[model samples]
Target: MNELFTRIVSGVIYAAAIILALWSGKLATNILFIIFGLICLFELQNLLNFKNYVSYFVFPIALIFFNYFNVNDEITFLFIIACLFVKLLLLRDLFSLKGRNAFRQKKHLITLMYIVPSMVFLTLIPKLYPDYNTYILLYVFILMWINDSFAFLIGKHFGKQKLFAKISPKKTVEGFLAGFTFTIIGGILISYFNQTLSFYNWVVVGILVSVFGNLGDLVQSKFKRKALVKDSGKIMPGHGGVFDRMDSIIFSSTFVFGFLFVINHVS
Candidate 1:
C-alpha cells in the first residue's frame, strides 16, 4: 500500500510537471530540463562514485549559452554525432566481458561524452521545432510514459522470454513489442492534435522511443547493477532517482533531435 501510494503520488507530480512545462512555453521548458540535467548529473556521479564539481558548474553555464545563442545546424549535428558515438562505445562496453570495469574506469569520460550531450539535445528540442512548439517535446514524454506503462502491464501479465537478462532481468520480448505497438498508437493519436508533425513522422518517433528508450533503461540498469544499488537516488519516491526517471529521455532525445534537425534542414 505504501509503495502504491508512492507510485501514484510520483506519477501525478511527474505528469503535472511535464504538462505545466509544456504549457508554459519554451523558456520554462528549457529551464525545467536544465534542472533535470543537473539532477541527473548529480545522480550519475553518485552512481559512478566519481565526485566532480566541474560538471555541476559547467552544465548550467553551457546550457545557458546553448539556449541563448543562435547555434548553427552544423554544430548541433556534430553534437548529435558525438553523442551517438559515445553511446555506441557504451554499448560495446556493455556487451564485452570486461564491460563492468571499463565503465567504471571511464565513468568521468562517459559522463562528459554521453550525459552532457544528451541533455543538451533534450534542451534543444523546443528551439528546433517550428514556432518553438512545446507540444513536440511533450509528445515525446507522453509517448515514453505510455510505452513504459503498457510495457510493464503487458510484460507482467504475459512476458515469457527475457529481452536482456544480463542487463535487465525483468524486461521481456513481449513487453518490448507491447510497448512499441502502443507507442505507435499513442504517436498517431498525438499527431491528430499536433498537426505540425505528420502521422508518419509521429510513428517514426514512436519507433525511436520504443527501441532507444528501452535501451536507455537497460543502460541505467547496468549502471545500477555495477553500483550494487537498486536505484540511482531517492529524489523521486517510488521512482528511484532523477537519473532513473530521465534515463529514457536522456538516451532517446538525441535521435529525436537528429530527426528534427534533418527535417529542418531539408524543409
Candidate 2:
C-alpha cells in the first residue's frame, strides 16, 4: 500500500516537473536538463564506486563548450562515434559475467564516453531546434513517458516471455510491442496538434523512443546487476534515482537528436 502510494506520488511529481519544464521555455528546459544531467552523473559515479573529484570540474567545462560553442557537424559526428564505441563496450561488459573490477578499471572511460556524451546530446536538443520547434524536444519526453507507462501496465498483466531475462527478467516482448504501439498512437496525436514535424518524422520518433528507450532501461539494469544492488539510489520514494528515472531518456535522446540534426542540417 505504501509502495503503491509512493509510486503514484513520485510519478505525478516527475510528470509535473517534466511538463512544466517543457512548457516554461528554452532557458527553463536547458537548466532543468543540465541539473538532471549532473545528478545522473553523481548517481552513476556512486553506482560504479568511482570517486574521482575531477569529474566535478570537467563536466561543466565540457558542457559549456558543447552548449555555447558553435560545434560543427564533424565534431558532433565524432562525439556520436565515441558514444557508440562506449555503448558497445558497455554492452560487452554487461554480458561478460566478469567481476566488478572491469567496470572499476574503465571508470574514467565510461564517465568520459558514456555519461558525458549522453548528457551533452540531451542538453543540445532544445538548443539545436529552432525556437518554435523546442516543443519537439518535449514531444520526445512525452513519447518516452507514454512508452514507459504502457509497457509497464501491459507487461505487468500480460507479459510472459522474458525480453532479456539475464539483464531484466521482468521485461516481456508483449510489453515492448504494446509500448511501441501506443507510442505510435501518441506520436500521431502529437503530429495532429503540432504539425512542427511531419507525421512520418513523428512515427520515426516513436520507433526510436520505444526501441532505444527500452534498451536504455536494460543497460541500466545491467549496471545495477553488476554492482549487485537493487536500486541506484533512494532519492525518490518509488523511483530509484536520477539515473534510474532518466536512463531511457538518456539513451534515446541522443538518437532523437541525431535525427533532428539530419533533418535540420544534412537533408
Candidate 3:
C-alpha cells in the first residue's frame, strides 16, 4: 500500500478507535487500557527480544488485576503476597533469557514500572479528588494526541533543527514546540471546566504535559531506534503500535496525575 493511503487509513482507524473507546464509558475505558497494556507489553517483548512467554502475559495481567484486588478487603493479602513472591522469583527468568528475549520476557515488569503506578493513581484519583479528575485525565490524553499529531505536521513543515537525530531523525525542535504549545492548551481549556484549577495550575500542568510528554515521545523513538524498527506494529496503518499512539500520554498521565494530587493535598 502507498504511504499516503496507509497514513489516511491509519488516522481514521485510530481516531475511530479512540472515540469508540471513550464513548464506551469508565469500565470500558479501563478494559480498553488493559488491552492496550497487553499489546504494549507484547510489542515491547518483541522489540526488546524477550523470550519467556509466561512473563510476557502473566505479569502484566497480574499487575493490573492484583492492584484491582488490593482495592478490597475481600481479596486476600495472602494471595497478593503470593503473586508478589512469584513475580519477584521471575527475576531468574530475566537473566536466563539472552539478547532480545530478555526484553520480551521482562517486558511486563518494564511496563509495570510505568503503568502499574499510573493505573493505581488513575483508579484512585476520581474517588479521592472531585471535579478535578475528568479534566485532568481528559487533558492528559488529549494533549498527548495533540503533541503527537501536530509535532509531525510542524516538524515536517519547519523542522530544520534536529532535536534527537540519533534517536528519531525526523523530530525537530520546531516541531516539538509546535506540538507542545498546542497540547498545553488542553490543560488551560480543561482548567476552565475543572473549577479547581487556577490559571497558574493550568500553566504548570501545561508545561509539564508538554515537556514530559515530548520526552515520552523521544523515549519511545529511542526504543524504536534500538529495536531497528520504524513503528511498533502495523495496527495503526500509518501510525505505530499502541505504544506509539499512547507514548506521550504514558508520561503525561503520571505527571499530571501526581501534580493534581500534590496540589490538592497542599490546599
Candidate 4:
C-alpha cells in the first residue's frame, strides 16, 4: 500500500536524522536541533495559535541554548527557568483574559516550553558527556525506541485496559506495563555493554524514561486534543509530524541528559 511505503520511507529519514545528530558533535547536533525547533514551533503556532511575542522569545532563547558558549548545564537549567518567568510575567494579561481565547492564544507557547528545551537537551547531551556522549545517547534512544515499539505491538495484540482513555484511547495499561518492562530490559542490556554506565544507573534510567516518556506522550496528546488536530504535521506518513514522532523522546532525552550530567560530575 502507499501508506505502508510512505511509512517506510519516513522511518528511514527519521532514523537517519537521529543517528546523524547523535554521532555528530555539538555543532552539527545543534544545527539539527534548531531546524527541529523551528519546525515544531511553526507547527505549534499554526495548530495552537500562540502569540507572536512568545514565539519571538522562544526563537532567540533556543538559539542561545544551542550555542557552543552555552555548554554549562546549570546555566541552561537557569535559562529555562528564566524563560518560564518571562512567560508568566509577559503573559499575565493574556492569562487574565478568563476566556477560551487567552488559553488558545497561549497554547502554542506552552507547547514550545516543552518542545524547545527538550531539543536543547538533545543538543546538550554531547556537551555534558563529552567523552561518551554518543554511546550514552545511543542508550537513551534505544530504550525509548524499544519502549514505543513494544508498546505498540503488544498493545495492539492485547490491549484491554485503556491507560488514559480520555486522552489517548489507543494507549492501554497492558501496553504501558509492557513498555516499562522492555525499557528496563533494554536499558540494562545496552548500559551493561557500554561499561561507562552502571547497572543501577541503567535501572534508574529505565524507570525515569518510562515515567517521563509516557508523561511526554500524554502531554502531547492533551495538546493535540486541545488544539483539535490529529497530527502535528504532514511531513511523515504514519508518524504524523515531528512532535508526533519526538513526543516520547523529548522527555526521555531531557531525563537522560540530566541523569548523565549528575553521574558524569559525581564520578
TM-score of every model versus the real structure: 0.95, 0.92, 0.74, 0.82
Which one wins by TM-score: 1 or 4?
Answer: 1
TM-score of 1: 0.95
Residue lDDT tens for model 4, 1-267: 787788778977987897887687555666676777777776656666554457546765766646546456577667556544433432343334444443355554465565667667666665665452666666777788788888887898999999988778999999999999999998888775876678888888888788778877876676677789899898788889887888788756666666766787788
Model 2 / residue 110 / CA error / Å:
1.0
lDDT of 2: 0.82
Where's the lowest-lDDT run of ten residues in candidate 1?
Answer: 94-103
Per residue, candidate 2 scores C-alpha lDDT tens digits across 59-117 of 66767788777878799978877887777676676667654444667888887677678
Clashes (candidate 4): 0
Model 4 scores a TM of 0.82
lDDT of 3 by residue, 1-267 (tens): 498788877777766665565565555556666677667766756667654466435544654674345355234334334333333333333234344332344455555454444443443444334422333455456656677778888999889999877667888999998987887776677677776678778778778778877776766675676688998886776677877877666645555656765676578
Compute the lDDT for candidate 4: 0.71
Q: Which candidate, 2 or 3, has the higher lDDT?
A: 2
- Top lDDT hit: 1
Ranking by lDDT: 1, 2, 4, 3
Which candidate model has the greater lDDT, 1 or 2? 1
After the best TM-score superposition of candidate 3, give how far the Cα of residue 148 lies from its true spot, in angstroms: 2.0
**How do the residues 137-166 of candidate 1 rate in per-residue lDDT, one tens digit apiece?**
888999999999899889989999999998
Candidate 1 collision pairs: none
TM-score of 3: 0.74
